[model samples]
Target chain A: MTFVLGIDGGGTSCRAALATADGAILGRAKAGAANIRSDLTGARTNIVEAARQAFLAAGEDPDLIPQTPAVLGLAGANVGTYKQQLEAILPFSRSSVETDAEIALEGAVGSGDGAMAILGTGTAYMVRKNGKSRPIGGWGFQVGDQGSGARIGRDLLEQTLLAYDGVREPSPLTAEMMGVFRNNPQDVVEFTTNAKPGDFGGFAPKVFDYAAKGDAVATWIVDKAVADVEASLGVLGLEAGDPLCLLGGLAPLYAPRLSERHRALLKTPLDDALGGAVRMAVRMFAAPVEAAR
Target chain B: MTFVLGIDGGGTSCRAALATADGAILGRAKAGAANIRSDLTGARTNIVEAARQAFLAAGEDPDLIPQTPAVLGLAGANVGTYKQQLEAILPFSRSSVETDAEIALEGAVGSGDGAMAILGTGTAYMVRKNGKSRPIGGWGFQVGDQGSGARIGRDLLEQTLLAYDGVREPSPLTAEMMGVFRNNPQDVVEFTTNAKPGDFGGFAPKVFDYAAKGDAVATWIVDKAVADVEASLGVLGLEAGDPLCLLGGLAPLYAPRLSERHRALLKTPLDDALGGAVRMAVRMFAAPVEAAR
Candidate 1:
């Protein structure tokens, strides 16, 4: 009757699930941000709190979180010693920490070999082949995230400044951006100075919308985004028929724009990342290792 | 017996010079950062401190800063209400706040109509024509500063990640960056997360060095930087023989790369920014404005 716990934590929120050892979900709950790299102690607290809430919702004592073996998919797990540092402080009977992208790939392609790209505010890729996992390009906004919504939005701002400088001809997209900023490049600069990746990602929709209408600047930006994504896919060694799923907030928008060759690899995800975490938890703690999908 | 003061303040340090009414520098001094936008109170403190030191060095009473009129070229003066705000809070009997680029332009072209670009960790342009000054692309690191050392280093990081992912072929520049980061993209990501523009700009010399040796990636990056700079110059409406000066830490590296048209316009600056400020201070407060040349 052992129950497994699965937690998915990100920069904004932490979610948890209580499920049977064989992977039947019983209850769910959520808590605050659990970005270990940014806030290790706080992330530990949030992870435990979310697990406690999930247990309570499952009609079990919250104190049982300490007895439950758990799997977690968390943001900032791949960089530095944050993962090991986090694992050491957890109260769960057994704890395993993996990047959010790893769980998402497992969720999308289900226990089999495949690849997935999370094209949200930031971009990260996860590939599983022959039971081995590899990660690419979750480098954050300062340097990486090439085909991400944040990158696209940043490109929009860059082009807007160029048009303002008469370095590039103004298009409808740039004109609208200028209007929003009150035709003040300083205002734009100020806005971006403290903008998080999500803040910049807010403008991605406008870029995609304008590109749909043939706005020259928007089209150029979108074209670059698509090219970058396709190029990353090539680097992943994904073939035309390989199982691939585009996850994250911008996935739907980018799906159709992928080159025809890579586009054929897209498939509906079998489960979301949390579900995958629960599935992994069950296998890691209860089921025989060979029984995993 | 009238004396004037000139101050140049930036993110790194604040410099001041004391001069007679005829624009002869009597003494110079330096203090800490006086970036008015990021820290008004601190900037005010540093500005006054620098002025005090300059006056003391000039064998005058430090308290006379309250009696002297000054023209200041500051890093953050161009953004928001910082200029006016700083002007109102100063101890000086009269103080004029101007962007650093303004002083640099005056320093280079000497009281006449012309243009200057400061190509340092950041890029900014200032044009003075018929006694009116216009600024372009001082939008800061996050949104503007195209063709800057900061931007060039950022481009190198971006390309390095691509090469690591196999999306781009490795070149000497990329390989060297990878080696520096110990062949770990995560290390690169971590290094960049908290990196300032100046931090990224630290790598600019390596880029130029590699470009000089014909590294494919470095050459491509430098070409883009040059094109962006040339484009901004074109937008400034400089003629083939306009009085143009390239200033700042990276100026020497970029000078040789300018197109023949812009190269023809390059001229040695008569003085640096602090001297330009002193000249302006004398003209504005002690000497006849028309006496400036």
Candidate 2:
């Protein structure tokens, strides 16, 4: 009868779920971006809104929601200051705030002794060992998030512009990009300017699609992306035989491009970050009531 | 005395000069971009303004100026359709309009017959022989301006974003870009969105500057640009023993990086595009007045 709530707050969107102690999903909800670095109040509201939806979907009353413990995997929560800020907003008597990277790692490898590389709106490589998480990269969309969907998207846009500038020979990929942007170079500028990390990241699939059609530039971009991911795995001290997990919308697209050494290390997760959050919540609440608080 | 006017109109700026039939410069003027494809009225006004200034600088009143023949080396004027559009607005009674690529070639070789590569706002390779111009590549900024300043700038920006997204390891080059953009990821978007071909081309110098400091990403960019330029030279049928002129702002930066074979072909221009334009104007006016018109 024990209920626990798990939340994964990302840059573009947030997901929350109500689950049983055994990882059975009872209900779930999704909301807008809740990254504290960009929006603090929005982050709080998104978490609360997602939680309320999950509880309501589970046919539970609002007053009864406080009985369950919660765990939040949030972007920007790794900063100590942000962790304190989040703790002030959530109602969980037993709750833990950690980076989305850490939560993704726990979700991908239930045992918490492995590593996970996330290739979503941005990219992050995280390892959890000895009850601590170490991250190699995840600086954001400005300084060091390589091998991520956003990186791939940015590359695609750049090559397209290079082709437009006649600095790169034209390939079918250039034509496709030009067509997508209606052949107006200004549109490429406009779309990229207004794009969020996730919005640009979304173009990763299109890059793959073009590559499949024999676009050399597109293929080059994909191959480069694979190399970037492989390099990240190497930085994590991951050997050829070590266990690793790939997560995010881009993982599947890049899966076919990984090296055999890295491919052998890949493992499909039994649960996602929300499930990991639920497990964390259950463990937190199992403590004595005084210790839990 | 016969007077000749030579004009070089590019994406960011225009240069015009009045010269004697013997290639002696009398005066010169600078104005903003006069690429007709990007700006029609602006292009005409810029040329007229620059010509007027040059005439005044040479101690001639605007109305007293002779109806000198002119040669315009302009970006975007190579496209046959665009050339016609430009011809309609320019004031020259008789003029020859050619791609900046051709002008760069004429500039590099002077009155000699040879080949030249330009890595300016855009990149192109052209060969001049028997008074006719043959171009190897000048496909515009979107399809094949390899080794150009614009390509290098685009690469630098893409690498910066990749580093910021945690998809790649941070390099000193990426760090430099972050610092230049004020450490704001959003500023990257803003700067790139508003970027003109020349703006991206402008970053070529920064890439070289960073490469000199041993930044891996900058070095990679420079290496790639050199490769691309060499490839363009190869396509132009440039032999080691043949004369090849290197013109454009980026040419000097790339000189130290070229292969001996390329270095052997490289020659400093005795006269730039402006001088070549003057030469062309003089030649045109030397013909029968009816033929000149």
Candidate number with greatest lDDT: 1
- Determine the backbone clash count of candidate 2: 29
List each model's interface RMSD.
1.4, 7.1
Off by over 4 Å in 1: A32-49, A60-69, A79-95, A285-293, B31-33, B38-56, B60-69, B79-95, B285-293
lDDT of 1 by residue, B202-279 (tens): 999899999999999999999999998888888787765569989988899999999988899999988999998997
User: What TM-score does each prediction get for chain A alone?
Assistant: 0.93, 0.83
**lDDT per residue as tens, model 2, A5-49:** 889999889898987755578899998888887788888888888
| Candidate 1 C-alpha error for residue A261, in Å | 0.9
The C-alpha local distance difference test score for the whole of candidate 1 amounts to 0.88
State the lDDT of candidate 2 residue by residue for B237-269, as single tens digits: 555556787777887887888888888877778
After superposition, which runs of candidate 2 have C-alpha atoms over 4 Å from their true positions?
A1-4, A19-24, A63-70, A76-97, A119-123, A137-225, A239-242, A253-261, A284-293, B21-23, B64-68, B119-124, B129-225, B285-293
Q: Score the docking of each candidate (DockQ).
A: 0.67, 0.14
